[model samples]
Target: MKKSIIVSTLILSSSLTFAFDLSAIAKNVVENVTKEQTTTQETSTSNLSDTTVSNGLKEALKTGVNYAVTQLGSNNGYLNNTAVKIPLPDNLAKAETLIRSIGGDKMADNLINSMNTAASKAAPKTAEVFVEAIDKMTLTDAQAILSGGNDAATNYFKANTSDSLKKLITPIIQETMKENQVASYYDTANNLYKSNVKGLVDNSGVMGLAKNFGVDSFIPGSSDESLDEYITTKAIDGLFTMIGQKEAAIRANPLEQTSSILKEVFGK
Candidate 1:
C-alpha cells in the first residue's frame, strides 16, 4: 500500500508540472506574437510617398486639433474635464483652502467656477492659431514625427508655437475673464476672507515673518501670477495636452485615423 501511494504522488507532481509548463509556454508564445506584430507595424510605414505622408500628418493634426478645440470651447468644457480644468493660482489656492475652512464655500466656489468659465471661453481662439501652424508644417517635420515617438508632433508644436499661442491666448483670456466676471468673483471672495480672522493673517507681522523665513513661497498671496497670465498659461497647456493625447491615440490604433490619407499612410 505504501509503494502504491508513492507512485501516485509522483504521477500527480509530474502532471501538475506539465500543466504549469504549458501555461508558461502559452505566455511566451503570446509575447512573441505581440512583438512580431509591433515590428511589422513599424516597418509598414517605411514605403509611403513624401506627399502621402505629409498630407496624412496634416489630416491627423487637423482632426485632433479641431476635436480638442471644440471640446474645450464648449460651455463648461474646462469646468467638466478635471484632467484639464483650470484651478486657482498656487498662492490663491492656499487662500481658497483657508476660505473653505472658515465657511466661505460659496465665494470660493464662485471664483473657481469663473476661472474655468473664462478658460472655456478663451479656448476657441486657439483653433485659428493651430490651423496656421498645421498648414506651415514642413515635410521634413512630418517624416521625423512619423519615425519618432508618439508625442513628437506635440513636442514640435510646443517648441515652435508656444510663444505665439501665449501671445494670442493672453488677450482672449483677459477678455473672457471680464465677460465671465472672474475678477468680480475674486473681489467678492477676497472681501469675505477679509471679514474672517484668516484675512488678518495677511496683514499681520506673521506674513512678514513667513516671508523672511522662506515660508512665503508656501504662503497665500505670495505668488506674482496675475489672474490673466495664469489663465492664459493654463489654457494653452490644456489645449496642447489634449492634442498630445489625440496624437498618441491615432498613432497607437490605426482605427483612430479617420481619413483615407491617414489610413493609407499609417497602414491597416
Candidate 2:
C-alpha cells in the first residue's frame, strides 16, 4: 500500500508541472501574435498616409498648371494679357520696316504670326511637364508652394522644367520660323543691316561689315545673346505667369460653381 501511494503522488506532481508549462507557452504565443498584428497595422497606416500626401501635392500642381496654360493658350493670351505680354524689341523694328518696305511685308507678317502661334501652342505643354514635377514634391513642398507668391510656383515650375521646355520650344520655334518663310525675312534683315553699317562706316570711316553679319565680334560689353534667348524664354515665362495669376485667384476667392472633385479637394 505505501509503495502504491508514493507512485500515485509522483504521477500527480508530473502532470501538474506539464500543465503549467503548456499554459505558460500558450500565453507567450498569444502575446507575440498581438504584437505582430499591432506592428503591421501601424506600418500600413503610415504608408497609406504618405501616399495620400504625395498624391495631394500632384493634384495641386496639376490644377495650377492647367489653369495657367488655359489662360495663355486662349486668344490674346500673351499680347493682350498684361501680366506676361511680350513687347516688341526695339532693335527689330527698323529691321521689320526695312523688310516691309522692300516687298517682304507678307513674309514679315507671316513671321509675326508664326511667333505668336508657336507661343500659344507651346504654352499649354508647360503644364504637362510641371505636373510631372509636382509628383516629386513632398508634403512640405506642397505646403510651401501653396503659401508662396504668385510667381513662386511659376518659378519653381521653371526651375524644374527649363531644360525640357527649351528642348521642346527650340524645335517648335525653328519649325515655325521655317514654315513661315523666316529665311526670306532674314535675308531682308541682312540687307538692311549691311546698308545701315555701310552708311555708318561711310560717315565714321570705321569698318563694321563683319559685325553686321555676326561674323566679327560686337563692341565690348554689348551682347545680344540674352535678347535672342528671351524670345522663347519670355514665352515660357509668360505661360507660367498666367498660371500663377489664376492659381492665386483660385486660392484667394475660389470658384463659385466648381466641380464636385474640385470642391472636395480645394473646398477645404
Candidate 3:
C-alpha cells in the first residue's frame, strides 16, 4: 500500500511539471510572435518616412522632365513625330486645301513645316520651366502624387505650370515664327486669294462647282487662331504628353529606377 501511494504521488508530480512546462512554452511563443510583428511594423514605417517619399517623387519627376526635353528639343522632333506634329489649325484647313488645289501645295507644306519647326525651337525652353516648377513642389504634393495613379506627376506639373508655361513658351514661339516668316506666308496667301481669286469666282458659282466636283470649298482669312498662339499651345501640350509617358514608364519598369531612392521606393 505504501508503494502504490508513492507511485501515485510521483505520477501526479510528473503531470503537474509537464503542464507547467507547456504553459511556459506557450507564453514564450506568444511573446516572440508579438515582437516579430512589432519589428516588421516599425521597419515598414521607417522605410516610407516623409522625406524618403518626397525625395523619391521629386527624383522621378526630374527624370521624366529631362527625358521629355531631350526627346522633344532636338531637330525634327516635332516635325517627325506624328503624335505631336503641329498641323495647320482647323480654321486654316480650308485655306490649306484651297492652296493645295491651286498647285500651291508647296506653300501650304511650308506653313505646316514652319509651325512644327517653331515648336521644336521652343521645346528646349521648357526644361527651365519644368525644373522651376519641380523645385517649388511641396512635400504634401509629393505625397499626393506618389500615392496617386501613373500620370499623377504629369498632371501635377500641368496644373501648377500651365500659366507659367504659357507665358514662357509664347514669346519663344512668336520669335521663332517670325524668323520662319509664318505670318508673312499666311498674309501673302490671304492677299493673293483676295486680290486675284475672289474677283474671278462668283461665290454661288464656286459653291456649285465644288458640289459638282464633290470637293469641300475653301475660304481665306477664316482662321481665327494666331499662328504663334496655336504653335505655343500645341508645343506645351506635346511636352506634357511626353512627360506623362516618361512618368508611366518609370512607374511600371523597375529597370527605369535610375537612383538608389527610386530603387528603394519604386522597386516594390
Worst 10 residues of 2 by lDDT: 219-228
TM-score of each: 0.72, 0.57, 0.72
Q: For residues 34-103, could you state the per-residue lDDT of candidate 1 as single tens digits? A: 9999888767765667888999888888888888899999999988998899887776777676678779
lDDT of 3 by residue, 89-154 (tens): 775776686778789787777888888887887788888889888889999898889889887887
| CA lDDT, every model vs. true structure | 0.79, 0.63, 0.80
Scanning candidate 3 in windows of ten residues, the lowest lDDT window is 216-225
Highest TM-score scorer: 1
Which ranking of candidates, highest lDDT first?
3, 1, 2
TM-score ranking of the models: 1, 3, 2
For candidate 2, the lDDT comes to 0.63
